[model samples]
Every structure is written in structure tokens, then in C-alpha cells.
Target: MTLEQNPALAPVSDLPGPQAWRDIGVVCPFDMALDHELWRWMPDGVNLIFTRTPYYDQPVGLDMAEEISDHGEIQDAVRSVMAISPAVVAYACTSGSFVHGVQGARNLSKAMVSAGAPAAVTTSEGLLMALDALGVTRVAVATPYLAELTDRLTSFLEQGGKSVVSHEGLGLDRDIWKVPYATTCELIRQADRPDAEVIFVSCTNLPTYDLIARMEQELGKPVITANQVTAWGALRLMGREAVGPHQALLQATKG
Candidate 1:
């Protein structure tokens, strides 16, 4: 029988309700494995749900291209998350966000809103907002993508009005999550240029939560990662303060 025919499939509403709680949904890429990093930053009383867009493997360009082409799949995922009645829905793929450029990111968010989400944001769009909030225009970038895809990101950023002082990539075609924190750290160091006002580490699947604050401290500048900005944007959509010690973006949200 279909879920509609099964009474047991109904959403649980009889359970004890918290005094207050919020639900946030993440529409992720198919190969995503770093969702736990988003969860790690979630405040108490917020529930995080995930649904995947079509993607398989990577070098960024291929996987992200597939995701961008799967507009139907992405809309369906957003609608599915809406079924849970989340306060905001996030398209949580960085490459997918900027792949089509700024207008594309805006279009993606519009589609999510059309899908019934009360509000929505994509990672690339989020990055732009986060950068504005931080008052930064010059940035250094590190990525777990090939040179071509990295070039796409730099162009996207430049189009967004940010100056990319330096950019570097690991040139990996797959297994991006396997990249260690130490490697990412070194990439940031190597990507750093004297004039860069901030450092941006791209890719939602790359693990980065453990060291964002430490990186910022060591670099003496903001070290923004994909997951952190994604989470921060969703929180902003929720009309809630994103409070997390040591995370510069989150800390910046405090009044």
C-alpha cells in the first residue's frame, strides 16, 4: 500500500511538544555526507531535516551540472521538506548554487519558494549575504575541486562584487570528504594573499566545522566555510540569532 493508504505513515503530532521548537530543512546534493556538520551547529530546540537532489560522484563540474539539471528533483525535495512544515528550506550545495551564477542562485531560491517553502536560500546566495554581513569584499578561496570548477567559483564571486585575491584547489575528481582538516588548513594557508580580507573554503561535502574558529584565529581574519554559512543563513531565515562561540559568522549575528 502507498504511504497515503497507510495510517501509520501519518506525521506524529501527538507527541509532547517542546515549549518552542523550530524545524529547518536542508535540500542537499546526492553525494552529501557532511550533514552532521550542519547538525553540530544547530541550537537546541531546532530540528534539521535533509532531502537530496540528484547527483552522483564529482569533480564538482559533473556532479554540480547534474544537480542543476535536476530542477524537478530539487523542487520535489523542497516540497517534501515543506511537508514537515519547516520554518525555512535551504538548498545546501555550494557548487550547485553558483554554477549558474548569481541570477541562477536567485532563480533556485525562487523555485524553492514556489515549491511551498515559506522561505529559502541557496549556499551561493548565502555566501554573498554572509560576506556582506562581514563587511568583506576581498577574499582568498580554497576548494576541493579541479582548476576549471575553481575558476567558475572565482568568476561567480567576482560577479557577486567580491574581489578574489587568491584561489587554489585540490584538483580532486571525487572523494572530496576524504580530504583531511590538515590538508584543508594547508590549502587555506597557501591560498591566502596579503590583501585578502577573508578566506572562503567552498564545497558542502567537505568537512570543516572542527576548525573554522581556529583557522580564523590563526589567520587573523574570518575563515568562512560552506556548512557554517549555510547554517547561518538558514538561522537568519528563521528570524533567530545564530549563536555559537568561536564561529565568527554565528557570533556576528548577535545584537
Candidate 2:
């Protein structure tokens, strides 16, 4: 007998709830391994549908960033999730958005919109929004990128009219998700300075959900991360708040 005809099976119309109250489409890099981290910022009653750029054998670098950020690749990724009708689509890769500088990041957002996303945001754009929301200028940065890649981020920040007071990097080309909390904490410590107003932990794949509040307490300054800001920006486009209890960026958005 067909499953639909089985007496033990419930009818499709008997399902209890809608797929979600709201949905956000996310386009991530092929090597993104920490999907749970992105979900941590999603509020209840909302859902995240994800897609990825085509896999590349090259390690994470300027070349890799360029490849993933290609308008064609991003447009295709965005199209894959258009069926969900998400309120907004986010390109959740920092280097990909920022590697080509300020205009490049904006182009990435436009690409998503052109591909049928109602709205779009990129991690680099989210970082800028987080900074503007907090009304701070001097920033410190921590990353798991090589010196060259780190410099590109600095340039991107400067192009957006923010000064990079100090920065540190782990110089890894791949497996940024594998960096431990202690090591990440140390990197933040090394990157922080009295002159800097906020500390930004770059890279969505590098976990930071559990560390934002603790690090803010330890450093006596607000801390922001890639995934945190990406979710925040995307949710904000939909007139919703991201779900972070003590995250400084989320708290700033509260009425």
C-alpha cells in the first residue's frame, strides 16, 4: 500500500504549524562548517534556509574570496533560496564581501536582490551597520586570516570611514572553524587596545556566540562577531531583532 493510504500515517493537512512565521535565506561559503552558530542568532518562530557557493579546492585567501564573491556565484546561490520567499537573504561571508572593498560589498547585496531576494545583506555590510548603530568609530579586529587578507579587511573598514586601531590574525588559510575558544579569546586580547572603542571578531566560521557577553565583560568594551552581525542585519531588514541575550549589538537595537 502507498504511504498516503496507510492507516497509521497522518494526512499532510494534519500538520500542526506553518513552516515558519518568517524565513531568512542565507548563502554561505562551501567550506562553512558551523551552521549551528548562525542559528544561535535566529529568534523563535523564524527559520533560516541555507545555500552554499560551489566548492573550490583552493584554500581561503584573496583568490578564494574573489571566487566565492563572484556576482555569478552569489547570484546563483541567492536564486537557490528564492523559493522560500525569505524576507531577506544574507551572504554570510566576510572576506568575500569585503575583499574588493566598499563598492564590492554593495554590489554583492545588489546581486542578491537582482537574483530575486526581497532584500540582501552581507557580513561586511552588517559589521558597518553594527558600528553605525553603536555610534563608534575606532575599532580593533581579530581574525583567522593571513596578514594580506587582514589588510584587505582593514582597507574595507577604512573605506567605510572607520579607523582600525589595532588588528591581529592567526594566519590560517583553511579550517577557521577549528580555532578553539581559548585561542580566539587570546587573539581578541592581543587585538584590543585602550584607543579602540569595539573589538570585532571576524569570520563567521569562527564560533563566537558563547563568547560575546563574556568577552565584553572581560574587556569592558562591546564585542561583535561575523555571524552575529550577519543575523542581526538580515533580521533587522525584516523588522525583527536577533536572539542574543547579552550580545552588545542586539542590546543596542532594543527599543
Candidate 3:
């Protein structure tokens, strides 16, 4: 029994070789609660490595968004994930990236690249790219933020040369992730307008993966969510496509 005679302990032949995982680093806000939603957009053989910015006790608001988006904090977070040498790093917070403005979003991506990420994408920038990919100019936006923050998103979109035909917000400063899909659907309904070519559901913490295709069918327009665009943009930078089956953004042919 001591001479390697245990049948249960014998190695099996034809074992698969080591997996070749394509890693994408994700830098999220401390309060981000939808890592699973991000994963839903990833294709097979891809892995998402997430690291969060330092926690801030402040409620989710302009100040909180600004604090969590600090360049130094984000750079540090990017460095924390650099050991894995991710193909691209994505800053996966919508409000944090857009709260400052278009240039602010670009700065965040630049900082991540400076911090050793070969490439970087911020959610706000991703939204712009999604709009471009879909060839849409007028958009309706739904958010779980206050009027002030929601207004900032409108301005960001305007700066990107997209018209914000209609927009709505829930005015909540925290617990955005806890929002139910029914409520979010109603918000989208309220935000949607006849002139809007597309509808954007902002806020990475807000859950919208299960609602994108449904909402698109109901609204008769493409629906792009924060997490969806973030993952799409990151994967596109790596010359890969995201895994949203019926989502228009994922299926769009970029020119």
C-alpha cells in the first residue's frame, strides 16, 4: 500500500493544458456593488480583476464622486492590479468619471496608462464611444443621482456633441445598487422621448444588465448602461467584442 498502489491517487491522463486567460483590470469605486453585472459582458477565456478606490464614508454625491475619483487614488488602484499585467484597465464608475467633465474623463484614462496600464477606459468615455458606435446623436439618460449630478451627465454628453433630449434622476445619494429593475424601467420610461435616438442608463452601481435588451425592445431604441459600455470599451480596446447577445451596442459595426 506504501508503494504508489493506491488507485484513487493515480494521475489521470489527457488532462487539459493550462488555460490562457485574458485579464482586464477593473478599477471601481468602493461602493460599487455590481461586479457580477460587469462579468456578464465578458466573453469566455477572459478574466476581470477588480480593485476599488479607498472607501469614503460620505454618501454617494458630487463630493463623494470627486473624492473617489482622485487621480492619485486611481493611479494607486491601477498599480495594485498591474502585477497581473492586464491587457487594459477600466475605471468602472460613471459619475466619478463624468462629474468633472469630458476632459476629466480623458485625464482619468491618461492617469491609469501613466500608472502602468497599457490602455485605460473610463465609463464616461465608454458611453461616448458607444454612442459613436451606434451612430446616434440624440440621447435620453436615466440616472439614480440627484439633479446636480444628473445635470453633469447631460453637460458631458453635450460636450461630446450628443444632444440630451430628455433626462431624469432618482435624487438618491447612496444605495443606488439596491434599486429594483422595475423602478429603473419606470425611470427609463420617464426619461425616454420621441426625439431620442438612444437611451443611456447611467451609474455603474445601478443594475441594468437584465434590463438592457428588455428596455430596448420596449423603447424601440438601443439602451446602453454604464457597466455595459465600460466592459465594451475595455474589450474593444483589446480588439475583442463584449458578450451582450441582443444588445445593439455590442452588435454594432464600428466604422
Candidate 4:
């Protein structure tokens, strides 16, 4: 009758031991699609839980009032999915995540916990963690957000003890669909700073798969994009890593 009465509904333990398959929840915009780039080099068996805000119209500015308005809808979707009891959940908007500054980051995590997934919240904000993990302080950035949101990101990173040495923003707001793959690649080429140790391609909506390898090579540095860091932090919270070359960090822990 209920899942509790059916073995198939329960978690199946693997041979020789128990390996948990945890879910990582993402709350983002509905019109946007999941780019496999998140797990590009990730291992296997990890899962994703995505919830998106129903669409609405507004200016592209990054004002606090506008930011709060957008997040209201996005967070509503997040709360609904969080009711599902995910292991960890994060609000996936880079611009929205940091709109309130560092406090916003803490608040988003707190919100996820309140919604019932008490593990952690990973954001484009979490990329800061990845940068810190990689020992990057001055970095390059790329984004699909408008100038307003990009400005907030600059402030957010500066507050984090890092500096955005150089950056680029495409100035798109409601429709992230128009950010062409070639344009995103060009943004990387143009925004990348020669002296920077890390390049942060800073949005989740723009597909990043095509440029990751090239960006690493050109900059001669480790590049951590938003989705990459988002995936890394979420998978780590889930206690599993998908197996693939994209998992540059988690591969060492697979033993």
C-alpha cells in the first residue's frame, strides 16, 4: 500500500556494504535547462532534484527589491520540493543567491534547512568555496546575468576576501535562451585575465561544456564555473560522486 510496505520503495543496499544514493535539490528558473556540465567529470550514481520558479516579467536590474521579488517565486518552488526530504538543497540562482551579500548565502542555507533538507545550500555562492579550496583570491569571471547582477557579484566576491580582476556580463535577464554557445566561449576568451589563477564563468543558465578545457589551457589555471562548483558541493553533501573525468576533485576519495 505505502512505500514503507514495499521493498522496492525503500533504499536497496549494495553488495558487500551499504552505499547511500542521496538527492541534491536545485531551485532555479523553470525556462532554464539542466546542462550536463554539472556532472561533466563527475562519477556515477549521484542524483539531482531540480525545482524551478514559474516565469514572470520584470526589469533586468539587480536592485534588492527586484532580487527579492524573483527569489520569492523561486524559493516557493524550492520549498515545495524541499518538502520531499532531499538530503541537501540549494537555491541555484547565482545573482539571487548573493543579492543580499554573504548574509544571503547564509539565509538561503538556513531556508533549505527550514524546508526540511538540513544538510547545506550550495550556490554559485559555493563557487567561492571551490575557489577557496583551490586557493584562488583574484580571479576572472563570466556571466549571463545583466550588468546589475554582475555588479552585485563583484561586491559579493570582494566581501568574500577575493577580487574580480576582470569580468564580462551578457546583459540578458528573463530569457537566458539567447546566450549562444559561441558567445559564451567568446566571453571566456575576452574576460579571462592572464595573471589570474582561477576563472569563474559565473552563471548556471549559460551552457559551459564547450569552453572548460580551453579555458583551463589558456589561463594555465584551474577554472571553476558556477555549475561545476554547484555540482561538486551538492555531490559532496550527498556523500556520492558520479564517476567521470569531470570529477577532478572527488576522484581521489573514491577508495
TM-score of each: 0.90, 0.93, 0.94, 0.80
User: lDDT tens string, model 3, 144-199?
Assistant: 99998999899999999999999999999989999999999999999999999999
Q: Any runs in candidate 1 off by more than 4 Å, and if so which?
A: 1-19, 55-59, 66-69
The C-alpha RMSD in Å for every predicted model, in order, reads 7.0, 4.1, 3.6, 6.2
TM-score: which candidate is best? Answer: 3
Judge candidate 3 against the unseen true structure and give its global Cα lDDT, from 0 to 1: 0.92
Estimate, for each residue in 61-122, the C-alpha lDDT of model 1 and write its tens digit: 74555455366788999988888899999999888888888888898899899989999999
Tens digits of per-residue lDDT for model 4, 127-221? 77777777669988777777878888888888888988998988776656557778887887788777876778876766765566665666567
Which pairs of residues clash in candidate 3, taking residues 3 or more apart in a chain or in different chains? Answer: none
Clashing pairs in 2: none
> Model 2 misses residue 203 by how many Å?
0.7
Q: Model 2: per-residue lDDT, tens digit, 1-255? A: 876688456677776555547999999999999889999888887798999999999988999999999899889888889988888999999999999999999988998999999999999999999999999999999999999889999999999999999999999999899999999999999999999999999998899899999999999999999999999999999988898878788888886
User: Looking at candidate 1, what is the lDDT of residue 113?
Assistant: 91
What TM-score quantifies how close candidate 3 is to the native fold?
0.94
lDDT of 1: 0.86
TM-score of 1: 0.90
Scanning candidate 4 in windows of ten residues, the lowest lDDT window is 244-253
1 or 3: which has the higher TM-score?
Answer: 3
Model 2 has a clash total of 0
Segments of candidate 4 deviating more than 4 angstroms: 1-20, 35-42, 63-75, 242-255
CA deviation > 4 Å runs, candidate 3 = 1-14
